[model samples]
Target: MNATRIGAGDRPRLYVSTTDTTDVTGDLDYIAIEHAINGEPVSLTTAEKVYTAQLLDSRGLTPTAIGRLIGSDPVTIRGWKTNGWQPAPTGRPHKASEAGRERAA
Candidate 1:
């Protein structure tokens, strides 16, 4: 089993892996069994809530106004603005940029 953390600055990501095939397969099988036995509901995190709020407020207001209302920094709100000022639908929607679409293709 191996676990690694990678990222820079305040944003960091975690990656976990197992070299042993049996261990990996067992882990996945266990996860599937657990989910089947006891299903769990998905919930939103604080950051997601904040982003949603900001997006909602921006619908009828400027980015600065939305940022102020949601207690988010202007720069972060600006980045979200560049991605199209549309509220995300229920569940995760594809909010891809031009470059992202190109790369995906």
Candidate 2:
């Protein structure tokens, strides 16, 4: 699909809601995709995966196809779709961390 320009205000925005892989994949290089596939740093992996899934989904790719691209299972991809592909929380701050911050302030 083509990008649509919205808003009648001074600053009109170009919104792309496409089913074309080229429109999505063209902006990403091989190295960036490789980094996401590697699941490095641990913390950002979930977000990376979810974001990639959303991009591929917008490009008219199937869950199975997205899973294949990202080295994940189709079931997991389906779950992402069910839950809106939101990344889970990584972890919580340490106990007393808020108190410590207040004291510092």
Best of the candidates, lDDT: 2
TM-score, model 2 to reference: 0.43
lDDT per residue as tens, model 2, 1-105: 866543234643322233432234455343444444333222224555676777778868888877766767878878888887864445885669888998999
Give lDDT: candidate 1, residue 82. Answer: 64
Q: Give residue 72's error in model 1 in angstroms.
A: 0.7
Q: CA lDDT, every prediction?
A: 0.42, 0.59
What would the TM-scores of all predictions be?
0.28, 0.43
Model 1's alpha-carbon lDDT is: 0.42
Mark the regions of model 1 whose C-alpha exceeds 4 Å error after superposition: 1-58, 84-105
